[model samples]
Every structure is written in C-alpha cells, then in structure tokens.
Target: MALAGMLLVAMTAWFVPWALAHTDWGNWWLAIPFVGCNVFVACTALLLAFNNSKRSIPLRVEVARGHEPLVGVIVPTASEPVDMVMATVGSVIDQRWPEDRLRVVVSDDGYSDELQARVATLAAELPHGVVSYFRPPKRGSAERIGESKAGNLNAAIRLLSDANCEFVETRDADDLVADPEFLRLTVSHMMLDDRIGFVQTIKESKTSEGDPFNNNELLFYRGMMLSRNADHCAFPCGSGLVWRRAALREIGHFPVWNLVEDIHSGVLALRLGWRGLYVPIVGAFAQHAPEDVANYFKQRGTWAIDSIRLFAFDRFRHMPWRMRLHFIEQTAFYLLSLPIMVLLIIPMAGLAFGQFPIDAAPMDYAVHFTGFAVAMELTMLAFAADRPLGAFVRTRVFLIGMAPLYAASTIRAFWYGAKKKPIYIVTRKTDEHRVYVSMLKAHWFLIAMIVFVLVMSARRDDFLLDFDPGSIYWAIVGLTGLGAFVRLSWFGVDVKRNILSRLQLRSKPDSHVQSDT
Candidate 1:
C-alpha cells in the first residue's frame, strides 16, 4: 500500500508543473497564489511521505540500574472542577515512585478559595510533604503574576525548586495517570541519556467514541505523533510531558508569555541542543476535546496562532538543517488555513467568471488530482493504521470544520503581534452540553459562500455540462464549503441528550398540572 501510494504521489508531482505551465498566467493575482498553493501542497506531501518512512525504534534504557530521581508532578489548573482536580491529585499520589521522592504540586491560577481548601484537605489526607499547592502571589503586579498556564507552571517550578526536585512531570488538572509506572518508565529514558530534555507520552482521551473532538485527538496522537517521533521533534504537548529541571532552568523556565508554552519550550529546547523523546506509550488520560464547540475552536486557535509565531522565530535559522526543516514543516502544518482558503476561493472564482485557471483537460486534471488526494489520505491512514475508520472520518471532519478558525487565528496573530495579551480559555468537561449561539452564527459566512457558488454555477450554461473542467471545479468548491458548514454545525450525542433533558423538564410541569386538575 505504501509503495503504491508513493508511486501515485510521484505521478502527481510530475504532472503538477506540466499542468501549471499551461495555466493562463496573464492574471498574476490569481496565478501566483494558485501556483504557490500547489507547490506548498506538493512539498507537504513529500515531507509526510519521507517522515512516515522513518519508523520508531524502541530506545534501550537500563531501567533497573538507573537512579530514581526526585520527580515533581505539576498539575496546572484554572477554574477546573474540584472533583477533577482531586482525581488528578489522587492519580499522582498513586504513582509507584518512592514516597519521599515524589512531590505533587497543584498550581492554581484561578486563586479560588474553594480550590485552595480542597487542595489543603487532600494534602492533609496524604503523607506530610507529599502534596503541595502554589498560587501566584497576590502582592505582585498583574504582569509579575504572569498569565496563562506558562505562568502557573513557572510559579509551581519556583515552589518545587525549594524541594530540590530533579525532574518535573507536568499534567493538566483534568488529566489522570492511567499507568502506575508512567513516571518510572519515562524517567528511565531520561536517566539513560543525560542530554534528554523531556519525554512526552501520548495522552488518550477518556471521552467515549461518539465525541468527534476526542476522536480527532486520538487520530492526531496516533498519526501525527508517529511522524514527529520519527523526525525526533515530537512536541511536548502541554500535558503528559516530563522535563528535567536542569534542562528547563537552562532555557529560563517556560515561555511564560507564549500562548502554547509547551510547544514553544519544546522548540527552544531543540534549538539549544537538548534531545526530546516521543514516548509512544499511553501514560495518561485527559478530558476529551472541549465539550463546548466554541472552547474547542478557541483552544485550536491558540495553537494555530502560537505555531505561526514559532515559524517566524529568527533563531530557527541557527539550528541544524534537519531540525530547522522539522520546525518549518511543523509550522507549515498549522499555517495551512490561509492556503486552504485560497485554494477553495480560486476554484470558485474561476467557475463564476468563466475563466478556467488551469488550461488542462478535465480528465487529465481529475486523474492527477484524485491520485494525489487518495495517496495523501492513504499515507495518513497508514500512519494511523491502528485507529478505526470511523475515528479517521471524524478526525477529518473536525479538521475540515476548523478551517475558518485556523485562518482567522493566523491572521489575528500576525496583525496583533507578540505583545498582544494572550487569551486563556479553560476547557471545561461537562455532561451538560450547551451550544454557543455565537459559534453557530459564525458559520453563516461559509453557508453564504456555498449558496453563492451554487447560485452562480446554476446560472452558467455549462453548469451541468459533463466533462467540463470548470463544472468540476465548481462542484469541488461547493462540496468543500458544504462539508465545512455541516461539520461546524453538527451536534454530538451529548447535545442531543441535553435537548431531551430540557424537553423532559418542560413536560414535567405540564404533567403535574394535568394530574392536579
């Protein structure tokens, strides 16, 4: 399957330039972005193919002989449910590490009195000195307190520093260690290589299979992380990442101001010559993607914006060529929203104005385009061979649905610059699913685009003309737009349940009134 896919990709690559040469370049405005978009797509396809070929080999570590270093478990929380926080704390306490060597620190950025008391109560129940809580100092100015998870983590690090901790495992308040040996296993790898800055384990979602957001996350961890692992640039995801204290100290703690501090820190560590290992083993389980679609997009938007910021960093030039290329590839992956939007728009414009951008036969173009698309999807599926087909479909749906959000975030990041105050939206895990009216309203523009394309295409004499390249292009644009609209507006089972519960509540009053009468 892999070889066949490669051959298809090769064929497409050969055909792209030949087809583009025939394009009407008289319209440079349309010509440039279109050509640029094709080039980016081809390059990305090749890069993925290359990375997918590099298989992950298990690292040999002398676990029995390695020293058990003092590990600090930092759980960063802001406005999380108390029960979730307690569950995470309990999981940390349950770790198999020596009681004296393990330290659990809950970093509370929300500074809620109730949370503080809950942590205090939990700490008292545990062995003295086993658990600690740190809140950003109130006396300092807002800037001094720092903001976002990065700030909370830095404060926790300062508190843990007094404990003489050697290694730190960072987890979200809602993430729980499913494996008792997570710390032991991950720390063993760190002990084997003095230069290993961090080991990031895959985070599985606890949410059920029906949740598209969680299903998408599962696909990413299974597919993208494999590619990243092969390239030795596995991202240190915000949660389920373990770091050496000295390595972090060398880099001046986390990037307190960055929106995606974990990713920024991972890149910085790579630039500074620290090795990062992507542990394929699942160690912890985190709450599924935000139940609230708005929160989901906001979280993704933050990542998209931060990734673009990383791509623009000047220091990336100084890294080894391979590392530099890896950083660029990773950045390009997130910065794709603009390119995708442009690609979608050009075809629609071509169909509306009766100007076929690519002067190629319908059959020839369709063959090449379909071949490339199929091969790319095949390659991605191969990477995620272990995942179910349903998961893969759901994942694609989520990615397609997020196009607008990603494009907006990228543009906003560049326009606002680095000094813009970071926005931190807490992802709440709730069974009560509520749709944001504003989020649904945001998709109106996409729906309008789809409708406009349909209307304009219907007006053309060749609208239903079979074998016409212009008609084909119009169909593709319409389908892409419609798919995006449907995915964005689709509700999950939880939302359905919420709706049913509301109806039940309303009907209960009517039933009681009828019985009384």
Candidate 2:
C-alpha cells in the first residue's frame, strides 16, 4: 500500500506540468518534500548498489589449507530441542577443517535436566578436544543466571584461552551450515588481514524448499539484507558471523544491559575501530519463527524497539556524523510508517466527503509523477530482490509492500523507545504446523486496509486525482502491499508442513483434545 500510494501521488503530479517545472515557492511547495524523500531513497539505494558490487577481499579456498586457527563455536540454548542442538553440534564436528583446529561449546542457558543430559550425551561422543557442557560462573548478571550465553561464551574463551584460539564464533542451536567450508571461508577473510576484526557469511533459510533461489520475496530482501555487510558502516546480525576473541575483549565483553545484544556489540565494534568484512558466500541456513505469528512479530518488534531504545540513549553522539545520519535515515523511514497511514487517510477522507485539498491542475501532475516513481521504485526493488540481476517485475510485493508496513512498524518502534525499556522475546524454532494459522489472522489486517483504500480511491476519484500525490500514493500503496503479506502468510503454511514432516512430529492438528480433570 505504501509503494502504491507513492506511485499514485507521483502519477497525479506528473499530469500537472506546472508542478514538475515550477520552482516558485507558491507553485511547487509540496513537491519539495515529495521529491526530497525520493531523492533520499534513490541516493541510499545507489550507495548500497555500489557497495554490493564492490569486492572487499579476494575469494580463495587455499587460505585455510596449511594452518587453520583454533575456532570455538558457541551454541547458546534455552529450552531448545536436544536432537536439533546435537545435530547442529554434530555438523560442527563434521567441519571440513581439521578436527584438531576446532572446538564446540554448547552453553546450557538454564534449561531442564533432560535438556542438560541430552547435551552431555552429545558432548561425550565428540572428540577429546571438543568440550560441550553447561555454562559456568561469570561477572554480573550472567553469574546469576548460571552461565548465560554471554557468560558461557566468556567462560568458553577462558577455557580455550590457553589453547591459542584465534577466532570465536556464535550461532543458535537450530542453524545448519549449508556448506562444509563455513569455517574455511569465514576464517580465511580474517586470516588474510589481522586488521579485520570479524567476518560474517550470508544466511539462507533451510525451509525455503525447492531451489531456494526461485522465491521472489526472498530474492527482494536479500539485497536489503546483504547490502549491510558491503558498506563501511554495516549493522550486524547475531548469527552467521565470526568475531576475534582479542578484539571482543578489547571492547568490554558483550554488555548484558541491552536486550538486543547484537546491536549493542555492533555499536561497540564501530567505536573500537575494528574492521568487519561481509562475505558474499551463503555458508549457513537459519530458520525463522516456525509456527507462531506472535513469535514472528515479537522478534521483529524486539529488534525495532531495541534499535530505537539504543539510539534513544544518546549513543549516536559517539558515532561518526555519516553513521549518525545513516542510522537516522533508516530509523526515520521505518518509524514514520504507521503515522503516515493516518496522514494518508485524512486527505482520503476529504475526497470521500468532497473537500479535496489541492486544485485540479496540480493534482493531474501529481498523478503522472507518481506513476513514474512507482515504475522506477519497482525496477530497483526487483533488481535488488534477485541478485546477479534477473526478472524483478514479477516479485513486486516485497518491494511495494514495505512502504506501509515500514511506516506502521516505525510508529510502533518510537512508542516503545519512548517507554525507555525493551521486551526480550525469542522467536520460536519449532517444526509444528500450527504456526501458519496465526498468519491467517495477521492477513485480516492487510485485507481490511486493502478494502478501505480501494473503496476510498474508487469513490473519491476526482478529488484524489486533484490533490497532491502523497495522499493518493499512500491510499493505494496499502492494496499492493497486501500481496507480500499474503505471500508470506502462504509461505508460513508451507514452512509448518515442511518442519513438522521433517522433524517427524507425532501429534496431528486434527486430533481430538481432552480437558484435564
């Protein structure tokens, strides 16, 4: 809907030549903000385009042949399945790199005895050098929690401290490495240059089933996602990244205060002046929230709220000016999404009641420009969605749907930030198919917005065509945005089935439930 709304306004503006050609303050006042927002988007997109194309480190496999540094892989678990955890650990044991050069550490973050025993059994089966067990004592809150992931990580480093371990890696229990060369590729980047503080590999989804590359929605987000690693100032994702133990210690070991420790660690890395390299190779696969709508939003919202809360604490002052501006651009664009819905609705309401804001002459131009903008935006989105450049037009939802949802999410973020706290919510990683039903619930919101926008546009056609392009663009953007939501909801069902069948869950959804006495 957001993208559609933007397009509508642009088309409306294009029809009025005066709006496009006029520089006089009175004539093109609104055009300034409209064009300015677009210019920002274009510039950012262009910068990312260049960054994505640039080669950071030359790709080579021979770097890991002779002397591979000792790497400790840390898996932090709290109520995660033992079989899945062991499978992930087993994969580490099966690394192409020499077993002598690798150590696996599984930190039990206060789970039940059954879970602890499961991890212990796997730990006993591993080679002598590899040690996997419950977490030990550490400073501050971690000690209180009996070996929290962070504390457990610190403990792992201390245990391996004497072994001359060079790199420390962290990932969740459910993640699977698609390529056996995961350590070889990531550690190679760090080995090539001592200055490089960390190396992060690209992440793919295992449940994507079928040629994972064929999906349109995944294709679109990959650009926005991977571009982060290409830039000089890139944000970090918790999984699929490797850090230097020495560098981590140089900065205070992962601060526990913030709920989103990944972002907190990122801010620290930048401040300490350590270089982070993003590898283009897809070495690992991680699952999204398996079967719960609430789980999905909780994860997304936690990230949104944490970003806002961290910035709210005046952390930007320590960052460089360019980075500060970058953060603001990203945050503002996301935060403004929700409120923009209302801003879009007001003029839409006026059209419904026959009190349109702009004159007919300007409205025509707005309509024209909106069409051009939509075309350009879609082209960019499609290109970004599919890397190495292939058919993008067919995958327009991921591109267009972002506008309204980004706005809505941004508004929600700001409210949470204002409250001065974060809610720690973990995404569920289950194989149960029950989660897909929840997506159907969220889809209703998209349906309502689509209906509202379509009805208003059809009824108030004349006024909408007359007013500035902004309002019209937003109203219609909602309709197009629903396509992505629906696509995701549909994908959820597939994910549930794949996960349940793959894991061999015993209980079926249709089975009768009996109440306890």
Candidate 3:
C-alpha cells in the first residue's frame, strides 16, 4: 500500500507541473498554493502508508522487585462539574493496583469553596489518605503559580512529594477508567522496559455512533497510533498516560508553558534517549471527541495552533534529524488546511471570472485523479475502518469540511506566536439535537460562496458554455461546500416548534389573549 501511494504521489508531481505549464493563464501565481496543497496531500499519503506497517506488539509481565511501587493517579480539573470529577475519582479507586500503593490526587485550579467541600466529603468516605485534593496558590499569594492544565499538574506533583510515588498516571477530570487492569497492564510494560519513559493507552470516545468527527478520532487511535508506535515515537495523549518519575525529572519537568505539553514532553523524552510505549488496549474512556461542529472546530483549531508552536522551541532544535523531520511532518499536516481551501476555491473563482486556468477537459483530469484518490481511500479504509466504503466516504466529507477551520487556526498560530497566554476551552457534553447559531456563523463565508456560485450558474446563460471545464468544476466544488453546510446546519424539530410558538403569539393581540384566558 505504501509503495502504491508513493507511485501515486510521483504521478501527481509529474502531472501537476506538466498540466500547469500547458495552461495559457497569465496569472502563474495562482498555481503556487495549489502546488503546495498537492504536495501536502502527497505527504499525507506517504505518512498513511508508512503507518500501516506498524502493528501493536504485546508486552510481557515482569516479576516484582520485592514490593509494589507507589503510583499516584493525578486528576486535573478546572471548573468541571463536581459529579464528573467524583466519577473519575471513583474510577481511579476501582483500579486493580494495591490500595496501599495507590494515591489519587484531585488537582482543582478553580479553587471553589463548594468544590473543596465536595472533595472533602468524598475523601472522608474513602480509605484514609487514599484520596487528596490540591489547589494552586491564590493569584496574588507569594506561592502563586502559572495557570493552565500544565500548571495545575505541576502543583499536583508538588502535593504528591510526600507520597514519593515511582510512577504517575495523568487522567483528565471527565475521563473514566474502562478497564480495572489499566494500571496493572501499563505498569507491567514500564517494569519490563526500564528505559520506557511513558506508556500511552488508547483513548476511546464515550460516543461515536453517528459522529464522523468522532469516528475519525477512533481511526487515529486505532491506525495512526499503531504506525507511530512502530517508529518508537508514540507520544502521550492528553489523557490515559502513565509516566516514570525519573524520566520526567531528567527532562526538567513538563513544559508547563507549552500549549501541547503532552507532545512536547514526549518529544523531549525521545530526544533524551528515553523510549515511549503505546498500549493498544482501550485503557480509559474520555470526552476527547467533539459532540458538535462548534466544539470540533474549537478543539482541532487549538491543537493545530499549539502543535505548530512547537517548532519555535529550543529543545526541538537538538533532536535527531529523523525525529526533527517527523515533527515537521506532523506540523505540516495541521497547517495544510488553508492551502487546501485555496486550491479548492481558486478553480471555481477562475470559472466565475472567465479565467479558467486548466486547459484540459474536466473528464480527462477526473480520470487520472479519481484512480489515485480511490487507491488512497482504499488503503485508508483497509487500515482504519472495518465498515463499508460508503461510511469512510461520509467521514471524509466531514474531514474536508474542516479545512477552513484549520486554515484559520494556522493563521492564528503564526499571528499570536507561542508566547501568548494559552486559553483552554473545556469540551462539554453537548446535545447534538440542537442547532448552534455560532457554528453556522463560523462557516458563513463558505455558505455565502456556495450561494453566489449557484446564483451565477442560474442567472447567466453563457456561464456554463464560455467556461466548460471551469463551470463543471465549480458545480462540483459548490455541491461539496453545500454538503458541508447542510451537515453542520442540522436543525432539530425543536427549532421549528419554537418558531411556530413565536408566530402564534405575535398573531394574537395582548387584549385578545387576556380575554381568551
């Protein structure tokens, strides 16, 4: 599959330049972003191919050295629901590790009195010293610390010093342990391989039935992580990760200031010659997947921006050449969104303006492109999903719709830089049965573009004839954009009921309503 993808990329590289050179369009500059977009797509195919070879390896359990090592399970929360926080605490308590060797710490940055009381009550009901709570110092206090999830976690480390645990497991406030043996399994790997700095477990979504975005995430964990693991570059995700205290200390603690701290930590560990492992088992369940379009954009955008910022870090400069290239490849994947959007829209713009760039017939281009696309899609489906091709196609539409949001995020990352204060957006459990006006507003430009193209196609008689290939391509692009718009604008029946109620009240006068009552 990898070889086939490489062949396709080689073909694209040759065909794109040849086709562009044959065009009579004077504006050669328009092809620059298109070329860039194609290059990124080819790189993605290569990466996907390389990832397919890395299957998960099983770990052998090791004999204990006299006594069980102490493990500190850190749960970081910032204004999350108390019930959710407590549920996570309960899950940690249910782990298969010895009770005496386990310590659960709730790192609450919100510092709320109600939260403190709840934790206190919950702790009292549990085993003595098994559960504890820590809060960052007050903002103006002498011991005040920097704010963010990283900061909250640093504070937890400090609070756990007395316990002096050999290993630390980081869990997000909303994440629950799916397997009671999660600790035993991950710890066994660490014990077997002393050089293993951290072990990352698979993060499965709480729900992914009807959500393509969520399905993509599941694919990422199942397929991509396997590939990364094969390369010995598997990094810690935001949650369900266990780390060795010695390795973290060697790396000078978590890069608290870095936005994508988990990745940063993983890279630093790798650079320092410490190995990281990927446990393919579903260790924990978390709300990492977005429930709606708005949340999806927000989560992906933040990740893109933060991941891009890693290039500026000084530690990244000292990594091995191969490691550096891998990091660059990862960042490039996130930053390709804008270029892709430009590539898609430019051809349509040429049609609207009577400046069709490509001289070839639409069918000719489609013939070659469709074969390569189908091959790539088949490779992906083989590795990522067990479902039919149609399901994968549907998920891909959502992925393509995300280009604009990713482009916006890449631009923001460059404009703001890494030094800017990081603002964490909490992912909430939202009702997908409602239409969020904000989500629609975010994609207004795409919606407007789709409407404008349709209007032009309908109003002008020569529009299709004058630009034969261009107009056809424009129709295809417009339909794709429309599909994205409709999928995102899924308004439930409640919206209609509310509108009807408003209309009924407006039609009735105040005096008439009172008389009727």
Report the C-alpha lDDT of model 1 over 22-96, residue by residue, as the tens digit. 676776677688778767766776666666565564463434534577788899888788888888888888877
TM-score winner, 1 or 2: 1
Worst 10 residues of 2 by lDDT: 211-220
In angstroms, how far off is 127's CA in candidate 1? 2.9
Q: How many residue pairs clash (N, CA or C atoms closer than 3 angstroms) in each of the candidate models, in the order given?
A: 0, 41, 0
The 10-residue segment with the lowest total lDDT in model 3: 465-474
Q: Per-residue lDDT tens digits of candidate 3, residues 1-517?
A: 5556566566666555655665545655554555456556767666656555546565645335445688998998888888878888888887776777888888888776777787789788877888888887654455644457776777788766778887999998888898777887788888878899999988876655655554335566666666666667778887889999888789876775666478888888998898888887777786545656666667777787778777654437766664565566667667656655765677657655656555566566555555555555556666555445545565466555666677777777777775684676766555455666566553566557756865775678775445454344444654675466456555333667888998999887776344533
lDDT of 2 at 284: 59
TM-score, ranked from best to worst: 3, 1, 2
**In candidate 3, which residue pairs clash?**
none
RMSD of each: 4.0, 7.4, 3.5
Candidates arranged by lDDT, highest first: 1, 3, 2
